[model samples]
Target chain A: MHELTVDLGDRSYPIYIGEHLLGESRWLQPHIPGKQVCIVTNETIAPLYLSRLKASLDGYQIHTVILPDGESFKTLEVVNRIFDGLLESRHNRTTTLIALGGGVVGDMTGFAAACYQRGVGFIQVPTTLLAMVDSSVGGKTGVNHPLGKNMIGAFYQPYCVLADMTLLGSLPPRELSAGIAEIIKYGLISDYPFFEWLEQNVDRLLVGDQEALAYAVERSCRNKAEVVAADEHEGGIRAILNFGHTFGHAIETAQGYGNWLHGEAVAAGMVMAADLSWRRGDISADELARVRDLLVRARLPVTAPDDMTPARFVELMGVDKKVLDGRLRLVLLEAMGNAVVTSDIDTDLLAETFAACR
Target chain B: MHELTVDLGDRSYPIYIGEHLLGESRWLQPHIPGKQVCIVTNETIAPLYLSRLKASLDGYQIHTVILPDGESFKTLEVVNRIFDGLLESRHNRTTTLIALGGGVVGDMTGFAAACYQRGVGFIQVPTTLLAMVDSSVGGKTGVNHPLGKNMIGAFYQPYCVLADMTLLGSLPPRELSAGIAEIIKYGLISDYPFFEWLEQNVDRLLVGDQEALAYAVERSCRNKAEVVAADEHEGGIRAILNFGHTFGHAIETAQGYGNWLHGEAVAAGMVMAADLSWRRGDISADELARVRDLLVRARLPVTAPDDMTPARFVELMGVDKKVLDGRLRLVLLEAMGNAVVTSDIDTDLLAETFAACR
Candidate 1:
């Protein structure tokens, strides 16, 4: 197993990445200090891996809240059901809550732990590649609102994040591609060689290459942990970590969440960002083309849907968290493996970029 | 205006206590830097004070979401409405959320700020006595779940808290008395002299003595701010602030929230706690009498509602945030003003205390 640390002083925790780490009972034992443990999973994941996870949690008083899977159900109403499970089981602030599914389950479960008795213990065992490489490491836990995705949530960190590579073997190709989008994102934001590495291994990753997958997950988490530690609350520099999210979240919002997976939207959003960057003279057309080529090779979308108009994008993007005062701030790539948040885009230029992406 | 800092490093905020604070542009100015503002006030409060609050936020573009007033409406479903208002208004992370009512408003708004776009800026313009002294300062933001009060929420603090004492003049006598319950709590937890001062000036407070009210509000906030700064997440000493809340929340739950005001239920819960303390030999009967007498003198309930059974109390208290694993922990008075949380009372003794109080 490979271990990476998210240095958050007293709240600091480790992320364990490797093959079949889930089968290692040692990983589960240290995090589960109390007798009462509530494992929150989803219907899709529960049948595939619940028994093994439950067996690892043997000798503890366990309760399971198996939610119907999908981004569609990520709402406060669904999160309330988690409160019901904890209360009915008499789970206290000290009780450990284990999130054993994808980003939706991890986000909901982490949020449930954060709000259950003001806050409680949470351990993220991310199953999907999207979660393992992106959402799972950060303490950003929340549910979706109809008006926006991840609109209602908290910056509550987990006790640990266990990303087992064996779990990736069961992920569908479409889902695997979605995860690749985020893995590629890590390269774009902070790491040049990592971006180059992802460019080379894109096909291998899609084909379920264990070595390539493990390296990508570890590198992504390392980058994510550093960024999260530096700016836990997005007061300043942390906004950079949200690379293509402003445009991505708008796409997710415009499509009415669940219609587009977060990573797929993000993949298209990155293209939009690249287009905007190219228009702004921050990146050459070649760099933008390279970004598009890599995403295309990874089986991710490289353009916004035809239906997503510039006006619709503007309307949806206005509600994004990154919008400061009223300006739409976006993370545009300055060069390969580099990005900067710019709110300086001209209206005609932004509309032109949106038009190009569409 | 008297200012008390909650001293939480970078997340610390100032609590301003004075008459007509809501009308003061100075308090609102530094906290609200952005052009967008959302004032969340309930229907009951909006009619009385919304315009005055809006007047203070003059230069900023402000939107209002008037929630139906009641503890029952303090749910995620209701909080979603606030999100709709912000999204509909195109409010972003820079938009400041001003909570303009009592505990419910502060909680929902603070929580909305915490969850809206992962988190945003918020300011508290508390009108009620309960809010001015206790709820607003501690940064405990959340809505009640059907299974538990404040089961869905965050520890997100506001940029500033503006407590306007003058608003108390228009408050109903019962609501005013509810505020006194928390004011008295600060005394019970850490200040014996404050308790004695209340014993002497309870009548002046009930009759609307501004000087007496101001002193109580300032003192209560000071006590609360100190505890919250020391243990922000209730990991240890902070739980002491919830001296009677376990029982109080149970009362709220058993009576179906809004049946008993939070402070009224807490008032009764404090009395029950004192009764339990006396039964546990932590305090003498006279001390217990003094506790109940102060509550009565303040026109607060001093016993559990007759309909509440020991079994019901046990069940409800079991779901309290203070409960560890499955054991019931109660904060009991040890002297005139000092208190300690103990899970050591005999079951028979606890039953006797419940039966006696009921």
Candidate 2:
């Protein structure tokens, strides 16, 4: 087992990565301040792991809320089901909520915990790679609005995040590719060597090689934890973490939420951002090719949706959280393994990238 | 204008208590970090003060959401209206949400600010004495759940709280008395001298005498600010600040929210707590009589609804935010000017208080 702490002072918590850590009460119990436990999972995840998670929570009052599975279900109305379950079962201020699914469940449950009784304790037992690597590590918890993705939420950190690697064995192939998209993001934004490492071991990770998967998860979390520690609220350096997210959110918003997975949209978005970066003379054409080829090799999308128009992208991107004071700040790569948030967009270059990427 | 800071470390904000401070942008602009401003006021407040506020915010992008008035509308569905207006208007994270009504609007707006794009800056322009003195200062922001009052919320403070005293001139007599119920709460729970002052001047405040109202608002805010600063999340001593809330919430819940204004419910709830305190031998019969008399003089309810049975009280109180584990922790008077949270109640004594208070 490998462990790393997201150093947030008093709000700091450890992320444990290992095999079959779900049934172990030792990793979860310490963070639960009270005896009442509520497990929030989705229909797909609950049938697979709810009983195991509930078994570990023996001797405590337990409640389970199984929501419909998918990105489209990630809304305030759906999240309210968790609140309904908690209140119906008499979960008090000290009760702890355990999120047991992919990013959707984790996001909704963490957000529910953040709002329940002003704030309560919550632990994250991520069942998917997308969550274990990106969403679960940061304190960003929220639901999607029709207008934008993650537009309604809070930065409420979990007490602990238990990423049991064995759970990934059940993840679908397309979902696995989605998770790798975020892992690749770490390399593009901050760690070039990891990108190189992923280039070499891309096949092994694709086949669910245990050792390769463990390393990817650990490294991704370490990169995320470091960025989050320095800027918990995304005031300065943390904005770099959303390297492809601005363009990706536009794709997600354009395609409708559940149709394109967040990671898949981000996968295509990174390529779009790279195209613009090359046009800005920040990265060479060869470097951009390498970025595209890596995601292509990993079985991820390398182009924006054909149906999405430039005008649509502009309208959607304008409403993204990254937009400040009417200026659209895009996180672009200054060089391979380096990113900067810049509002200095050349409209001609942007139009060309939008035209070319599709 | 009398200004005092609610010292919450870096999250601290000033409460400007005086006559008509809302029209002065100096009291508001410093807290607004961006050009976009959204004023979340109910229909009742918008008709009264929205234009004056809009005039003050001349140079900024402004959007207004006029929620329906009264406590019944304080729900996640209604709060979502604020989110809709924010997203529709493209109010970015830096946009400051100005809550321009009473406690319900403040609670909903603050909660919306806490969740909008994870979090955003907000300023409170509380028009009611209840909001100006108690709810607006404590950083307690949330909407009520069907099962309980304020069962869901966040401890999000505003950048500044502008308590415009002159706005109270337009307040209805019942609502004005409701505000005084909270003012009297500050006196009974923490300030005996203030309690004596209220005893002598309750009539003056009831008649809207500016001097007496300002002094009461200032004193009430001071008591609350001290309690909130010491325990921002209600960890320990802050629970004392919820002196009559447990019983009061039951009454409010029993009456279906809007029927009993929050303060009216609290007024009755305080008498119930005083009754219990006298039975517990924490206060003399004379002191308890004084507590009841002050609320009556202020034209507030001194007893629970006749239709609410003790069984219903137990059911509702069990789901309160103050309940830790399964134990019901009641905030009771330790003396004339001090409060304590205790679970040690003789059922017979509790039954008698529940029976006798009605």
Candidate 3:
């Protein structure tokens, strides 16, 4: 197992990446500060890994709530069921909540823990490739709204995140590819050397090469940890991490959550962002082609859906959280390995880029 | 206007108490970091004060969400409406939420702001005495679950809190007296001098003596500000601030919310606490009588309702947020002016206290 720490002072927590970690009491036991344990998982994952975790947490007063899987279920009302179970089981402020599933389960459970009794101790046991490299590491826990993705939520950090790579063995091909998009994001945002490594190992990553997967997950988390440490609340630099998210959220919301995988949408969003960046003269045509080539080879979408018009995309992106002072502050690429969040975009360029993507 | 600060490092905010604060853009405009502002109020306060505040906040992209009045409306579904309004209005992360009602409105709005896009800027414009002295000062914002009061919430601080004393002119007699219950709480927790002052000045406060009322409000806020600043998240000293809350919450939840004003339930809860403390030899019978006398004179209920059985109170209080591990922590008066949260209590003493209260 490899370990990394997100240095957030009093809220700092460790991220453990390894194979077969679900049953390892060493990683799961220490963080729980209380006797009552509530493990929230999805229906798909419950049959696969619930018993393994239950064995690890054997001596505690354990409880489990299996929710229906999908991003569409990420609502306050569904999250309320987790709260209801906690209350019914008589879980107190100190009861530890274990989020044992993919990104959807992790996000909903993290939010449930955050709101339950005004916050409680929680451990993130991410089972999917997307969740292990992204959602589980950061403390950004929340649910999505009908009008927007992740519209209502909290920045409540978890006690720790346990990323068991063996759990990813069960992820479908498209799901695994979606997680790789985020892994690719870490490189695009700041590390050219890592981006080059990913480009070289793309084939190995796709064919279930465990060593390649481990390296990519570790590097992505390192990048995530550094950025999260510098700005826990996204005051400045953390916004760079949303390079493709502004466009991607629009895709996810417009397409209806769960209709398109988050990674697939983000992959397409990154291509659109690259196109916009090139139009603004920030990146050369060669760089934009390199970004698009990567997404296409990874078997992810590289363009907007046929149903989306420039106007619809613009309207949806208009309400994203990145908007500041009534102007959209987008995380745009300055180069292949660098990005910046700026509202200074040429009106014609933005419109043309959307038209091109559509 | 009299102002005091809750010193929580960078998250610190000011509490402004005076007459007619809604018109003062000097205090409102600075904390608002964005052009968008959403005023969240209930049906009772919207018609009386919304237009007045809107006039002061001229030139901003303002929106309003007026909810049904009362504690019964404090649910996740109801709070979701506030989120829906913000999204429908296209308000982004920088949008500022100003809660312009009593404790229910303030708590729901603060929770909404705390969760809207993982938090946004929020200001509290308290229109009730209970809110001014208690809810608005501390950053404890949440909604109620059927099983418990404040079972779901976040400790998110607002940018600032505005307490308009003149708004109290419209408050009913029972509501004003209920607010006094929390005012009395400040004294019982750690201020015998303030307790003595309230005992002597209860009649003046009840009769709407502005000078006396101002003194009581300011004093209550000072006490609240100190406790909140010391603990922030209720790790230790802050729990003392919840002296009467356990029994009070049981009273509130048992009778169904809105039936007993929060402060009214707390008033009876305090008497029950005093009765328990006296039984344990922590206070003299005379001291207990003094506590009961003030509550009776304030026109607040000094005992639990006749219908609540000891078993029911125990069952309800068992699920409260304060329950740590399997033990229930009761905040008992150590003396006339000091209190402590202790899990150490005799079983018979607790049952007898419940019997006595019933």
Candidate 4:
């Protein structure tokens, strides 16, 4: 197993990545304070892997809460449902919650755990490739509000994360490609060699090559762990990890959530950022084209939908969490595998870039 | 002004207590980061003192959101209204949220500020004595859930607290007595000299004696600030502050939230705890009688309602935030002005204590 510590002092925890790690009860047993465990999952993942997980939790009293799959279900009401289950099952503060699905389950369960009697222990058992490579590792747990995505949440860390690569085999092709967008993001933001490596092995990743997939997940987690360790609360350096998120969040809000997968919106958002970077003379046109080509090869969207206009995009981006003092601070590319936060970009260039994406 | 620090390292903040401090713009102006300010107040306080508070916020863009009075409005829906007001008023991260009312407004606005764009700055302008002496000073911010009270929230601190003693003059007799319950509680749990002083001056506190009220508020705040500084997240020593809260929360939940003031229920709950402690031989009968006499002289409830049965109280207490591993840990008095957390009390004795209270 490849272990990466997300060094957050007392709140720090380990992210274990490898094949067949889920069956190893020793790693999970110590973290769970009691014999009673409640595994939170969804309709899509429960049917496929619930039994295998239950087998691993043999000595403990286990219960399961299966929610419907999708972003729409991530609400305060749904969070209450998890609380009801825990309360009804007589689970106390010592009881542990195990999130056993993708990002939605992990986010919802992590939030539920955070508010359950002020806080409780929770473990991430991410099944989808997107969650395995990104969301599951970070302590950013919350539910989406109608006003904005992740508008209601807390920065509560999980006790541990068990990223079993074997679970990725069950993910749909579209979902797998969506996960690649974030993998590419890690490389684009800080690691040039990883970006070049992805360019060389894009095909192998597409066909479910286990070795390539494992390597990508580990590298992505390592990159994320380092950034999180430096700034657990996005006060400064951590904001850089939000590359494309400003535009990506705007697109998600404008298009309405669940219409486009988060990674898909982010995929197109990255291209917009790259183009804007080139227009500002921060990066060469060649680098922008390379970014677009990579997103295309990964089978992710590279342009915004026609219905999304620049005016709507601007309005939507105004409410983004990263915005400050009415100025839209965006993470723009300095070059391939390099980014910086800047609010000095010309308004005309930004409008043209949004128009081009649409 | 009396200044006390919460001492939470970088998250630490100062609590300023005095009469007419709200008009002192010098203390508040430095914390207001941007040109815009949003003051959140309830109907009762708005009609009386909003203009005076607004006058202090001069030379800046100011807006007001008036909510209905009472605990019923302390919901996530109300928190959303504050968010809507913030968005509609174009308040940004730099905009400061000033909570200008009682406990309900302080809690909901603090929560609203916590969730707006992940978080923003907030200041407490507590009007009621209950809020000034307790809720407003500590950074414990959250709204009540239908299933339980304060089931969903975060421990987000404020920039500063403005506990203006002048506002307490507008409070009703019942509200003033309710605030005294918490004041007496601080004396009961941590300060013996304060307890003796409260016993001698209970009549003066009931008649709205300004010096007695100010002294009580300052001492209670000092005790709470010290506890919060030692255990910000309630990991250990902080649990002692919930002296009567385990049973009081049950009383509040059982009677329904707005029926009795929080301090009244807590007053009755503390009587029961003192009786329990006496029965366990941890405290003398004279000390228990003194506790009841002080609450009674202050015009707070010293007996439980007729509807509350020991079985029902037990059931409700099970869901309290202090429960751990199926055990209900309660803060029981060891002697006058001293307490300890214990789960070893006899069930029969507890039932009898409930019977006696009813």
Measured by lDDT, the strongest candidate is 2
Candidate 4 regions off by >4 Å? A249-256, A305-326, A347-358, B247-257, B306-326, B347-358
Candidate 3's error at B149, in angstroms? 1.4
Point out the worst 10-residue segment of candidate 1 chain B by lDDT: B317-326
Q: List the residue pairs that clash in candidate 3.
A: none
Give the per-residue lDDT of model 4 (tens digit) for A282-331.
Answer: 88888888889998999999998888888788777763334534477789
Candidate with more favorable, higher DockQ: 1 or 3: 3
Q: What is the lDDT of candidate 3?
A: 0.89
How far is B179's C-alpha from truth in model 1 (Å)? 2.4
How far is A301's C-alpha from truth in model 4 (Å)? 3.2
Each prediction's whole-model lDDT (CA): 0.86, 0.90, 0.89, 0.85
Give the proportion of true interface contacts each model preserves, from 0 to 1.
Answer: 0.90, 0.90, 0.92, 0.38
Candidate order by DockQ, decreasing, is 2, 3, 1, 4
lDDT-sorted candidate list, best first:
2, 3, 1, 4
lDDT of 1: 0.86
lDDT of 1 by residue, A222-258 (tens): 9888888888888877788777777888787777777
- Regarding DockQ, does 1 or 2 come out ahead? 2
In each prediction, how many residue pairs overlap at the backbone (N, C-alpha, C within less than 3 A)?
Answer: 0, 0, 0, 0
Winner by DockQ:
2
lDDT of 2 by residue, B1-358 (tens): 9889999999988988888787888889888899999999988889889999999998999999999998778999999999999999988878999999988999999999999999999999888888888888889999988877788899999999887888999999999999999899989889999999999999999999987898899999999999998999888999887888889988976887678888999999999999999999999999999999999999999999888777777677663334535377788989999988887776667778888878
Candidate 3 has a DockQ of 0.83
Docking class of 3: high
Q: Model 3, B1-358: lDDT tens per residue?
A: 8888888899998878777788879889989999999999998899899998999898899999999998889999999999999999999888999999999999999999999999999999988888888888889999999877789999999999988778888899999999999999999998999999998999999988777888899999898888888888888989998889889988988897778988999999999999999999999999999999999999999989999989888788673334534467889999988999898877678888899987
